[model samples]
Structure formats: C-alpha cells, structure tokens
Target: MSTTTTDIALAPGTWAIDPTHTEVGFVTRHLMVSKVRGSFREVSGTVEVAEDITKSVVDVTAQIASVDTGNADRDTHLKSGDFFDAEQFPTMTFRSTAFDGETLTGDLTIKDVTKSVTFDVDFGGVGQDPWGNTKAGFEATATVNRKDWGLTWNAAVEGGGVLVSDKISLTIDVQLAKQA
Candidate 1:
C-alpha cells in the first residue's frame, strides 16, 4: 500500500510471525552450472519493535527436518549428516543483535555452530488485513559460506568443479501480526 518509513512507523510491540504468510528460503549453485533453491516448510519467529526501531529485536527458528526442494530424495539428503544432520541438529536459529535501518545483524546457528551474519532488509511497510489484524512485512537477503557451518560434504564433478558450491544465498520474506 506504499506505506513508507516516514508515513508509517512500525508499531512498538511484539509481533508474532504468521508462518502461513512467511517464507524462509535459500539458493545455492549446483554442479557449478545451475542453481538449486529450497525452503524450510516450518518456521516460527517473533519481532519485538521498540519505540525507537533501532532497539527492536528478531528471533527465528526453522525446522531442519521440514526442508523441501521439490525433490523428496534431495530433501532427504539435505537433512542427512551431509548437510543439516536433522537427527542431531533438528533446527536452525537466528537471533538479531542489531538493526540499523538498512542492515540487520544476527547470530545464525546451524548444526550447533553460531556465526554472526548481516542481512540487507527491506521494510515492505505496515497494513491491516481484512481480518483487522495489524501486519508488517519485510524482505531480507544474505549470503554465507556453507562450509563455515561445517556442511562440507560435496562430490567432484566428472568433468570439473564440484557438485555443490560453497556459497549459499538466504532469502526471507516475513509477515508479522501484532500480538494482543
């Protein structure tokens, strides 16, 4: 609805993520030629907006077992020890440490390893749904090295390069409803 930061400030309150309207996805190079995209089907999170938006906080968790890549076999492999090792890790989490208008810095944990990462965030504005719920939307993106999280399993291609690239791109589209 074109609500800019100057026009509509994020209401100061705790906002609960609407899982049905939010997406946590990623993209990575496959076989050094193409890209493979996937998403976690189950995610939960909350955003605490302060009177001063810079004081806000964000926390999120994505179930590793709920990974979907349009291919059941590939999903299974992603959840295995080669990747997330869902049996042991179960979930990946992110806790924001800072938010400065354009950038959001957070500690991301995967497979028990926590590292600080920054995401470029675009505030998509605030609005009210037909149901009368106050909602806020945001789109964020970041890139990280998969190997940094200890997800190093990869196969060499017959001709050249590797089956999987080390860089992974993360994209998040979130919609939060202000909690009562």
Candidate 2:
C-alpha cells in the first residue's frame, strides 16, 4: 500500500518491534551462480514516529551469533574470524537518519564499521490486533556491499569469481506494537 504523510501521522509515538513476528534476513550470490539466504533468529528494535513524519526514526540490532543459514557448519564459519567474528563483534546495528514516507536512510554498523545506507520501505498499514494492541507493519529492503562492512572473507572458485558475492541484499519485515 502507498504510505502517505497521513498514514504515518496516524502511527505517531513509540512502537516496540515484535521479534516473534519480525524477520531480519539477507541474501547473496554464491559461486557467482547460485544464491544463499539466511536470517538472524534474534533481533530487537524500536520505531518512533514524530508528529512530523519526516522526523521518524528506527533503531535495530541483530545478534551475529544467531545467524542461521540452515547448515550448522556454514553458520559456524559465519561467526568465525573469517566473517563476522562474533566473539569480537557480537552485534550489528542500524539507526535511521532520515525518513520521507517511501525512503528511509540510516547508518548501519557491522564489525565496528558504520556506513550510510538507504532502504525502500513499504508501510503495510496500522491496525489493532485481536488482543486489542495497536500495531503497524513495514517491509524494507536494501542492497549493500559486504566488503564495506569488513565481511570480505572469500575463496576463489576454480571456474571464476569468488565463493561469495560482494553485494548483500537485506530485507526486514517488522511488526511493531505501539507502546503506551
């Protein structure tokens, strides 16, 4: 649905992300031929909407050690020094710097490296749940260079290119419960 200033205005105030219904995921090309996808099991965030919708903000964090690609061995490798080094950098975070109805620009920090990124957000509308809780939903997506975040570890494939692609696609589907 197209989100208007009016739609956002209706969602003003602080909302807590419902991790049980939210997903923080990523995808990247593997061996330059196939794609690999994964999601973090643990994520926490907050969305604050100001009277002026453009001033809204979002802050989120994901535990690196909770990344799951389905394969145990791959998950271990992802948490090792070769990639996220979960022992040293246990978390990755994002804090929004700007929001203008359709676009949300933010600072993303991974492995202690922070970079500015933009995501296209789709507001799924605001409503009340069966429990009578005020809620809002949003789906956001962005593409970023993994190398920029110090996730540069890779192996050369015999055919060509590397084992992992530099570009990582991120998708976040969040359901937020408005706080009193």
Candidate 3:
C-alpha cells in the first residue's frame, strides 16, 4: 500500500510542466453510437520525485468552464445541470493518494461529488526535451459511472434507448517537471 507523499522530493533539479504539451481529457458514450472526446485548456498540476522518478507523486486540477467540444450549443448544454453544471462547480480536482507500481488511487471530485478512483497509471519514465528540460511522463485511464455522481440526465429514445451511457472513460496524459 502506497502512502501519502508527505515528504516528497524534487528529484535533484528544478523543472516545470509545459502546459501546452499536456492533456487533461475525457471520453463518454454519445447516443450509444459514437464517443465524444474533449480536453481542458486551463489545467495546473505538480509532480515530485526523489532522485529518480520511480518514487514520484503527482496531483492535478482543472477548470470546468474551459471545456470545449467545438460547438457552442453543445458546450452550453454541458455547462447545464444535465452534465457538468459548471456554474455551480467551477473546478474538478484529483489528488493522488497512493501509488503502487502500475496502479494509482486518488480522490476525484466533480460537481461537488467526490469518489475514490483508481487508474492504471503507466510511467514513461524521465527524459529530456529538445530544449533541455528534465520531464517525467505518465498516462492514466479509468472508467466510472457518470450517474454515480448524479449526472443522470437523459432522454428516452423512440425505439427504447437512452441518450447517454452511464460509463465515462477518462484519460490523462501528465507531463511533470521537477519544479524550479
């Protein structure tokens, strides 16, 4: 059982994440036919490691209003109570609680609802960018019921189907720097 990183280290140097190079995104079933994917533009997070990145930790948070799907009406609808209700809950947060090799358990909060979620986190290890900054990368993905947090709005189909599925898959590609 990985414990809280109370005394986390900063590897041995200072580095920072390239927000333009990171992605915080999600995927959900749309009309039970195709899937929709979107990402946030304004996201901030941090990562800490000791010597090497293998014993590192990460925490991240994102702004809800920054969600965009390339459509104005659809984005408005998503901001309503049917989905994110961005007006009320302006932010979504994820704080890593434990890191066990390939699995990471953390608290995920959205729309005022909080849940303990585990993600299959695969580390890409640390490397140097072309500009010469030390960076560590990781990708995490998980599926959870959207209705579990009261995002239950849906419409019944004429022949008997629902507008949206309950399961939503979230994928995150985090690029962390040691922080200067």
Arrange candidates by lDDT, descending: 1, 2, 3
**TM values, all candidates:** 0.96, 0.96, 0.85
Q: What is the lDDT of every predicted structure here? A: 0.92, 0.92, 0.75
- Candidate 1 lDDT over residue span 1-180, tens digit each: 322335437889999999999999999999999999999999999999898888899999999999999999999999999999999999999999998878899999999999999998888888999999999889889999999999999999999999999999999999999999
lDDT of 3 at 107: 89
- Per-residue lDDT of 128 in model 1: 98
User: After aligning candidate 3 to the native by TM-score, how far in Å is the CA of 37 from where it should be?
Assistant: 1.3
Cα RMSD (angstroms) for every candidate in the order listed: 2.0, 1.2, 4.4
lDDT of 3 by residue, 1-180 (tens): 232233223365434555777888878777788888888777887765446434555667788888877777977888898888899998888877777666777889988888989998766667777987777776888998987788889998777778788888888887776565
Clashes of each: 0, 0, 1
